[model samples]
Target: MFQLGKTIVSEDILEKEFVCNLSACKGACCVDGDAGAPLTKEETKILEQIFPKVKPFLRPEGIAAIEAQGTWRVGTDQDLETPLIDEKDCAYVIFDGSTALCGIEQAYNQGVLDWKKPVSCHLYPIRVKDFTEFAAVNYDRWDICDDACSLGKELQVPVYQFVKEALIRRFGEDWFSELETVAAQYQKSPRRR
Candidate 1:
């Protein structure tokens, strides 16, 4: 692990390759998880505010779930999270045939809401755990993402590069630039392998 600002970043994020192969996985990461998407405290508030605007883009079941459970719920870990429908998929999950997509994201794409989906969902494979002193940023390896790993390897993209925008969104531009510099130096060393 290495420190970036106050966050301790895992080496797996730099060593491993992962790019979502949506065609193969069909957004299973949204639907197949044991719990709903993780949300920041601020995102919970955003969800409550944007629900009315994002409701139109969601399925009837999703809307019902949201209405019944509220916009977000306290997760098993005592963290805020999106509510699940029938304890199966996330309440905000909308389908394009068999493909699961975020209703909040759909609304954002259509210019209905300013905020996209939760940063936790956006920064898949990189789970960030916040502490009073520093945050732990680590890779979450899952069997569901095997296809993505293969695709990423074929495309020659590292996890950090693939999730550049999300990293910048979570951290700041300056922090990301520092990370890029670190990546460059890490690449030059024989320890990269």
Candidate 2:
């Protein structure tokens, strides 16, 4: 692990290639997980506030689920997460034909809400585990993202490169720049395959 400021980043983050092949995966990551997307304590409040603006973009079923459950709920692991429907799909998840998408993001795209989707969802394949002193950042390997891995490898995009904007959003520009320098040096070492 490489330490940047207070964050611990996994080497897989620099080695693993992972661009989201949405057509191949059909946005399964949003729907297949046991728990809803992880949320910050502040994100829960943002979800509640933006639900009204995002409601118009969501499906009736999703809306009903949110109404029945709160905007977000504590998962089995006690992590705060978006509420799920039927204990499976995210309550805010909407479908466009066969592809699942975030309704909250749709609203954000339309400038309806200031906050986009949760950082956890935005920073897919990169899950952050926040501790008292620091946050552990690691790549999440799941069968559902095999296509993404293949596509990322084909395109020669590392996980950090693929999730650049999200990383910058979660961390900061300086941190990302440092990571890029570290990644460049790491790639030249021939130490890891």
Candidate 3:
């Protein structure tokens, strides 16, 4: 298991060997809270190209804010005062009885749209905490229950490879090296309770 601050997670849970029964949860992650996630420059450009309507919502300044403050708010009700979407919670969510799917995911899969998604969408459950030693990546179990959710079930080798590529495309090679160091440290650390 991995530990980040107060959160604990099992590595086995992250491996693709498991399958997430999100159908049972009815896409609870998407509908209940804000669709909070970070958008890289590439993602923002792609989003602007595809979803012009959402272009105004992409905050370049907010990215700097998140880098400085470690978090930022995305999406709000019509009043625009309350947070409606975040990294762990997405408000424009829909569950078709079983298998939680986001409209963005569906659109990308259907070829109706094309854009680089935010990092949060790419790295669900796992969050990256910037650090001088190494950026800490850990699972956000509190976002959902402890039930084993298989991220690998929906992922194929090509998709996984693409995600890795996207990471490089978004954060550059240096960030990946830093992530490797963090992963190595976690592997060497004592097991979490």
lDDT of 1 by residue, 83-115 (tens): 999998999998898998999999999999888
Candidate no. 1 TM-score:
0.98
Q: Model 1 Cα displacement at 48 (Å)?
A: 0.4
List the lowest-lDDT window of 10 residues for candidate 1.
184-193
Question: Which stretches in model 1 have alpha-carbon errors above 4 Å?
Answer: none
Q: Model-by-model lDDT, in order?
A: 0.91, 0.92, 0.45
- RMSD to true structure for each model, in Å: 0.8, 1.0, 9.5
Among all candidates shown, the one with the greatest lDDT: 2
lDDT of 2 by residue, 51-89 (tens): 889999988888888999889999899999998889888
Ten contiguous residues with the weakest lDDT in model 3: 77-86
Which of candidates 1 and 3 is the stronger one according to TM-score?
A: 1
